[model samples]
Target chain A: SQTIHQWPATLVQPVGSPLSLECTVEGTSNPNLYWYRQAAGRGLQLLFYSVGIGQISSEVPQNLSASRPQDRQFILSSKKLLLSDSGFYLCVGTRFSYEQYFGPGTRLTVT
Target chain B: SQQGEEDPQALSIQEGENATMNCSYKTSINNLQWYRQNSGRGLVHLILIRSNEREKHSGRLRVTLDTSKKSSSLLITASRAADTASYFCAVTDSWGKFQFGAGTQVVVTP
Candidate 1:
């Protein structure tokens, strides 16, 4: 069975601070990875997706960026956080079909 | 502009009653998927209906798709209080980038 793990389940950060959220999938290789953000009472917004190592696709333009350093490791980072950057961030991995398996998610609060 | 749009942003129903949500997409898709999310949690995959197929069922969940209309519907039978969650329809286009709808928030009262 494959499982995904995300770190710093919750984070509080000041404006203009650097941010890093990590996501790792166990038991899968060359899996499709994606990052999505959800605002309160709003639908999920796809931020980025990675098809393979060193390949990242940005769905929406923002201060945040995503990278897949290793086949099973995906990361979302920002050089400077903005108040609007605060939201619930999710990491998902998919294999075989288009069905995505999502992680618990990390709630980021930018004050 | 969103690719997938779901009707009825919110729905409230009594337990044991059936709840149905509809989604429509603008462009062609290779497949369509439904997901459920509890508040403050990651989305859980419910079902996936391929473009070639019309209807599919799993347990108490039923999904129907109409490629001509570019729409799909999800029906939950004998709903329970635990069924309360937000349901989202995601469309996987030919590009392979899955786009999600605004979602329907279902509240099942016991």
Candidate 2:
């Protein structure tokens, strides 16, 4: 079975600080990866998706960006975090069946 | 703009009652998927129904798709308190990109 892992289950960063969230998948290679953000009481907004290393398709324009450094590793980074950047960030990978498997998620609170 | 819209923004039902939520989308879809999220956490995959399929069942959940009308519904039978969560409908286009709906919040009272 495949498993997705995300680091720093929770974080509290001050406004304008740099941010980094990492996600990795085990038991799979070259899988489609996605990053999503869900604001409180709102639907998920797609941030970025990568089909391969160094290839990213952004869905929404924002202060956040995503990178795929390795086959199974993805990172979400921001040079200067804003208050609006606080939300629950999710990392997802598509299973062989075409359904998505999500990581535990990282809750970032920028104050 | 959202490609899919789920009806009944919120639903409250008893533990033994059945809960049904509907989703409507624009344009053609290759597949429609249902997901559940607890609080503000990541979404968990529930079920997926291909455009060619009319209905599918898994455990206590049933999903029906109408390609002609571009709509889908999810039925949860004999719900439990643990089923209290927000449910979302996602549609995949021909290129396999997933678009999610606003989600329907379901509250199962015990």
Candidate 3:
């Protein structure tokens, strides 16, 4: 059984502050990783995805960036947060192609 | 945008009743997947129906896909209070690009 974990389940930060969210998957290697953000009362928007280490694809050009420093570790970061950045962020790991498993998610509030 | 669209943005049903949601997309797809999201939580993949397949079942859930119509439907039988969540249908293109619909929020009352 594989498990996906995310840190800082909830965050509240002022505009222009730096942001860092980490996601790790245990029991799987070379898995596809994705970052998605959901605005309140809205559908999810894919921010970034990685096929392998140091290979990140941006679905939507945004202020946030993603890094796959390790095979099982994926991180979402921002040098400066925007008020529009306030939303729920999700980390997903897919094994065997397309069966995606998601983490608990982090709620970010940019004040 | 070729993103999928779910009908009945919101739905409320009594416990033990059936709940149905429809999703329509415009484009060729390799597969369509259904996911459930509890309030303010991450999504959980429910089922995936390949373009070659028309229907699939898992436990009390039934999913039907019509490639000709570019549509899909999800039916949850004997719904429970725990079934209250948002349902989203995601379409995956041949290149493995995935796009999700706005989603249908379902509420099952006891």
Candidate 4:
């Protein structure tokens, strides 16, 4: 089983502030990692996904970016935050490619 | 978009009743999955049915897939209040890209 850990369970940031959310995986090596954002009462929007170290794919054009510094570590960053960024962000990890295990998630409120 | 669409956006039912939700997708998929999300928490994977599979069961969960209709259904038997949450259906294409539905909000009252 793979476990994903995310930091700063809840975050409050002002517009234009820099943001960095970290996600780390345990019990799995070289797992695929994903970052998704969900607005209140909406479906998840895939922000980024990584298949390996130093490789990241952006699903949508936005202020957010992703990095996989290590096999088990994935990071979501933004140089300048926007009010639209406020939402619930989720980090997911998968080994077999079909089933995904999610982290507790981070609630970001950008004012 | 390849996102799935869930029907009857919301549902309310009493405990011991059955809750069924339907999901329809736009394109062909390699597999379809169901997930549960409690308020203010991450989503948990509940079940997965491959394109070749028409039906599958796990404990209280029953999933049926119809490739021809590009749709799927999830049924929860003898529901409990604990089952109150948002349920989402995700479709994975052969390329491994996944798209999730807006979700069905289910309220199981005790």
Predicted structure with the largest DockQ when compared to the true one: 1
lDDT per residue (tens digit) for residues A1-111 in model 3: 678999899999999999999999998788888888999988888888888899998888889999999999999999999999999998887765366677889999999
Ranking by DockQ: 1, 2, 4, 3
What does candidate 2's lDDT look like per residue over A48-107, in tens digits?
988889999988889999999999999999999999998899888875436677889998
Write down the C-alpha DockQ for each prediction: 0.53, 0.49, 0.42, 0.49
* Error of model 1, residue A55, in angstroms: 1.8
* Local error of candidate 3 at residue B36 (angstroms): 1.8
Residue A71 lDDT in candidate 1: 96
Tens-digit lDDT track of model 4 for B1-110: 43799986999999999999999998878899999988757788899999999999999999999999999999999999999999999887776666678789999999
- Report the C-alpha lDDT of model 2 over B17-105, residue by residue, as the tens digit: 99999999897888999999898766788998988999999999999999999999999999999999999998886766667888999
Measured over the true interface residues after superposition, the C-alpha RMSD of each candidate is 2.0, 2.2, 2.6, 2.2
Whole-model alpha-carbon lDDT for candidate 1: 0.90
Clashing pairs in 4: none
Question: Clashing pairs in model 1?
Answer: none
Poorest 10 consecutive residues by lDDT, candidate 1 chain B: B91-100
Q: Candidate 1: which docking quality band?
A: medium
Error of 4 at B70 (Å): 2.0
Per-residue lDDT of B85 in model 2: 96
Q: Per-residue CA lDDT of candidate 4, range A3-82, in tens?
A: 99999999999999999999999998988788989999877877888889998988899999999999999999999999
The Cα local distance difference test for each model comes to: 0.90, 0.89, 0.89, 0.90
What does DockQ come to for candidate 1? 0.53
Per-candidate TM-score against the hidden true structure: 0.89, 0.89, 0.85, 0.88
True contacts kept of each: 0.42, 0.32, 0.26, 0.39
